[model samples]
Target: MTQKRDLENKDGPSAKKVNLEFKKEEIEGFFNDKIWDNKFQEEIKEQVEKSQPYRWGTITELMNDELLRNVRQEVLNEIAFKKKETDIYKVHQSGDLANLSGLDWDDLSRLPSLYKLRAGIYSEEFRDMISRITGSGKLSGVKTDMSINTYTKGCHLLTHDDVIGSRRVSFILYLPDPDKKWKPHYGGALRLFPAIVPNVPKTDYEVKLVPQFNQIAFFTVQPGLSFHDVEEVRADKHRLSIQGWFHIPQEGEPGYIPGEQEATEARSTLQQLQNKELQEYDFPKPIRNDIPADELKLYRGLGQECAFSPEEYSYLRKYLNAQYLEPKNLQRLADVFMEESLVELGGILNDELAGKLMDSIRDLEINTKAPAHSSEIHFPWKCAMPPHKQRFMYIDGKESLEASEEGIKFINRTGPQELPNFQLTGKAATNTVEELFCQICSFFKSIAFRKWLLFLTRLIPTSDQILLRRFRPGSDFILATSTDSKLARDNTDEINALLEATFNFTPTATNSKNWESGEFGGYELCMSSNASDDEDEEDDPAIYRESDPNDDSVLYTSQCKWNSLCLMLRDPSILKFVKYVSVNAKGSRWDISCQWNVESSDKDDEDEDAATS
Candidate 1:
């Protein structure tokens, strides 16, 4: 039998073998003179110590120019990268470089430049200086983790605080084309988000570092406070980098503390649970409950064969296409909705109304500019808060939350306690978009539509919350995760929510060529709620990747399109999100998002009968 030893402690044979690989002088030139110079170390250390959002720093011209350039070329020539996407990032990645240690000598010899770079990064000279500079305590020499990643056009990393496992310091060494300068306008900048509270990050970023070739950016891994992300690469270029971590010392190693690692892990876990509790305070508040039987009957009395009276159809004809209002087409659509719990209807509006809407929206885009940052977005449109959860522009008939730490606390106190009344406030006809949106919301609340929906889905909606959303190009998305089960639980005695709807009012989102394969997002996606025995689902579920495309979980994916309406039954465990709208999208994805609390008569009455009998 083979024996296992504490390699992490640096006492084992593995440590000795690694120690012999690189000499101090060969790798000393890798760092800039200022970094190692005894005279300048204190100045740099002080700067890193004082930095905001959280303590972090960057160093330019890291590694010998010739050696680093050679390493970049060798990597491009030797490696195959697979697209690795998760809730965190979308990037092309090479296999972990740490695996090199397991390869035979011959295989390892084939990658001489990489071996040198790895050894240089872990050198005693660099390690001690990094430890002292970041005040991160001693880092382990035996357990190293690293991999190469390339962020190409449309690639991005969302907000996360690196607090997993034994990692003490997280670092990235950028290697864009050595010969060409990386411009700031090209996107792919590393942005740091400051905290509103310990775990809650402010909506906007405080610091942004444009990456350049031969630059190294790093920060000590502080749970909750160290929030950061890679902005999407907009230009058609690759931002390649080596990403890795330095770990706290392991058993028997210098500066090793027996309980420190476990303590850090426990604290991170506890903070995550606390963070979830804080998020609960931010969800959309709903008013009322399932409409009473008498109230439901009021809508049902509108008549059986169709929802519209002759006069109502005449009024609706001004906007809706007559084909959709035709009896045959309505029956077909209703049948489809009954079985699938979903229906996507194109040409939802009459050409005259469609043309007016399209022209109006196009004019709005050209005349009144959209905000570049979420916070800068004007009222009527409010920025969603604490971007760690989601980022988008929306109108929910409630006061917008301020974007500061105190603002978050204030908003939390006001609470989304009551369901909103868009119709009450929406009655004031303002701009074209507002008028159209208000019309839609009011129509949803009408007796005729309620009757129409009841006949189609066989579920009576009791209450609703409607949001007019503008998924501005480049900066809007909702991360994957479901809402609280309790929000919809009373409708069904079981856990699932009965229904939800999104009326896509986008007038110019039909980029069928791009969205067909999801190459450039702007699609709404939902999956069947995960089963109980599956691994405990993450608080923030990982983004779905094509590599492991949902075998059967994906319930529906509605591509960006104009005048399309989608309705679906909601499952409490189901995860959903609006795929981040790409900067290159035709225009903002406009939609009226609605959540419904629905109940069915036969099922409720049958259960009541059983109880009485």
Candidate 2:
């Protein structure tokens, strides 16, 4: 019965063409005219050429203040934004503005300033001006991709060289609180990392720019050397910006080199990281298992239901948290483990011991300055090797001392290594902080704990690796990996021997609430393996996100919390990683990660053996 009125005067003779001329001066008013001035353009060009890590540049007051301020207001008033968290970033993103052409006039009227800015960005005068300065060549005016984003407290983006299917340039124009200055200490700075080689980035960053309203930052999309991250925002204020890319021209467009995009993809960071020679550095060190005869025998006999022996219970009473010692709690955990293949136990340590450990660690973190280099950390605090896959402080039961470059080279060059049996479990002799951690590492290797684990999961360890890990803020993490390094046996579907656990020792202050919004950092995430049969054996999940997290593939995830112990009877198909601890994290995410070569009891094999008997 009702019809919406069209914005067009359909009966008018000129309605079909509707050429309302937008003057050049109107477009010029959208940006700072000085940017197009020859002298400034040359300065910008030279700055890009000399930039560290890779070529990149930023211009403050890039757009006229009033116009950008109005654009920011329009965006905040009209756009719906949602928090999107994935492996690479945590940000609030607006719907992509790529289809601005389809917007009804009423909607367009509300976003007029945003349209003006977008148009100015793609205007020939601006595009060519950017091309000549960055030497990126001409850009495609028909293909614009941009979205508004707000990174409030805790939001961040991990390091990545933006070499995806891109035409040419990557850019971000900030629209943070105009009246306030975005300070460096407030944390959301654009940080750039240098490369040690063409594809490998140095552990630390060399360049950073604090965001400010009306500032525009851009970089040529180099394959690997352009490693960068958006530091977690720490202030109460929001750091809003518009980010997108300019593609190399499409067909029928000025800069369309026929095979340019394909050639660029060939040299993409994803491609570079997948190179054979480069994979020698992937982490979760190449260790395999060699089940001891005695350990294998214990596993076979443990059967469907098992429990800690009286002596083993007594031994644990002195060390473990009282709650886990309760038979009911242990039984509940066992039931869950049997059903889901994973379990979480809270209050896993005795209060007195936990208090002492907490006090000692707090004192150490406050008093003992952590070493500047991985090699500088003391014996028991050996740093995990290879920055690409993971980097954190850890001490193995074998007490792997600080790794040397030469030793790392040896490990990488050597073939698959064997996991150590608990032979060194009792070697630790002291009670100092250094020895305290070693003692726990040894405890993980102890026959009593091994027996308890067997009673709980009916899984026996052929060999074990215990690590005391310390993830400092802004510093550590493990990228996901699938180790089908162990062969699937007659009794199992996958190499399900990896019984892994994380005994979180983070203080009460850094619970999920502090980082649930993900600003403060230190969360543990797990996903189903992304490993493909087609990719080479050397391929592992990229330290980057392979796909959107919303895609149903993520299996389970947890954030850092105090006194919680996580157990996963993992198959080689399970991929796991600890999210990077932001520099803004209140404290280190401390934990003991234990891995065992477990022989889980298979129902079919047990039934066959029983029937035969």
- As a whole number from 0 to 100, the lDDT of residue 46 in candidate 1 is 91
On a 0 to 100 scale, what is the lDDT of residue 359 in model 1? 84
Q: TM-score each candidate.
A: 0.87, 0.81
lDDT of 2 at 104: 54
Candidate 1: deviation at residue 95, Å? 1.3
lDDT of 2 at 551: 57
Which one wins on TM-score? Answer: 1
lDDT tens per residue, model 1, 1-613: 3222111232323322332355677778766666778656677689899999788988888788888988898777766688865434678877667666554454445566777888888877888888888888999987787888899998988777777667899899999998899998888999999887777777788999999999999999888788888899999999999998898898988989999888877656235734556663343433334555687666534444666778777866766678877777888887897777787778777888777777878888878767877657665567765566677787776655666666666666765644455665465545687666666666766655666666666666776667788888877777666666675453344324747778787766655675666666768887655522344532222232222345576767787778877778876667777777778776788887877777663465578899999
lDDT of each: 0.72, 0.71
Off by over 4 Å in 1: 1-20, 267-274, 280-294, 297-321, 325-328, 414-419, 424-430, 486-495, 528-547, 604-613
Mark the 10 consecutive residues where model 1 has the least summed lDDT.
3-12
